[model samples]
Target: MQRKFLDYFLFDKKDNGMLETLYREDETSFPPFDTQEVSFYLTPEKRLSLKYPAGEKQELSYQGFRDNITFILESPFAEYFEILGSPYLDLEVRTGAEDLDLFIYRRAIDENGKTVVLKGNHGEPMDSFTRGCFRLSHRDEVAKDFDKVRVICQPPTPKSGVVPGQIYRVIASAHTGLNMFARLGHV
Candidate 1:
């Protein structure tokens, strides 16, 4: 029998309002998997938080492009996460109105050192609770070793359409392994 390991980290408004992987694990040494890091600013009321972890690799460069406003997750062991029973990274967004759209992309490098990107398919618009989820698996076997997940928010194109001083809350969570079920049964 093989021993399965599941690791997960939760991000919230606490801890100085920053979601980061720094010091959470030793990246210099051999790590079981790559740790996802996110740096952002949180409002005093804690209703709004913005994170931009994609850095120079950002693909969206339109007229309203804002730096450090997107979210990125770098996962090198995505296959393991799927085998453990938790394959998707779930993200929940809350806003004052229903005028927000989420764009998801997966970027990875193939064996030839070429870049491959995949876009997500969002069906219907979100209702009261704005939510979206993306898979970590890659379509190309050569680039299946790891995955770069990007999450961006598309505000209403018309400036006047958006609510003034509206607060947006984004919550990200995932089930790492089978242990999650065990913990639930015990509770």
Candidate 2:
């Protein structure tokens, strides 16, 4: 039998703060959803891997100093998990050039209705690829609120010049155990 699945935009605060239902084909009623603990593991190997049900993995090369390298995380389950809590993100940089930095950001919509990418207030860029678990939480008072985040990997600065053909291998994923509870319903 084909498995039934639900699609939810976990952290699109512009539309809804926590949960935004995507679609429901059946009229089956589900219980109320609640905040739950979720965890993620991102790894780089023969292929990228995300532990979450709808997570995604990608591979790309840096386009040199003139371009910004970016990765977007729009997982269907982002809203239900909290970075500051038990749920977290694991980033593994398997293969890449030295001196590369990774920056995290939250995607937000401004008053002007434009989509703005806000830099993470988490501190200095991750300068090592020693396989570490990271919390993508922002604690700045002035920082805007957001549900979803993106990652940017690039060289230190333009002054250092970009490596002509540098390629990076990375994996990112989230794993939310079934011990958590949630309001279940159809969109």
Quick one: best lDDT, which candidate?
2
Candidate 1 residue 123 Cα shift, in angstroms, is 22
| Global lDDT of model 1 | 0.29
Q: Where does candidate 1 clash, by residue pair?
A: none
Model 2 has an lDDT value of 0.30
* Residue-level lDDT tens digits of model 2 in 1-187: 1111112223322322223333222324322244333443333332222454444665444443456433333233323322322222334332234344444433333334344432212222322212222222211111122133322222233232234235322322222222221321100
* Model 2 spans with C-alpha error above 4 angstroms: 1-35, 39-58, 71-88, 94-96, 110-113, 116-187
Cα lDDT tens digits, model 1, 138-178, are: 11221222244332333333232334235433333232322
CA displacement after TM-score superposition, residue 8 of candidate 2 (Å):
42
Error of 1 at 5 (Å): 39
Name the TM-score of candidate 2.
Answer: 0.27
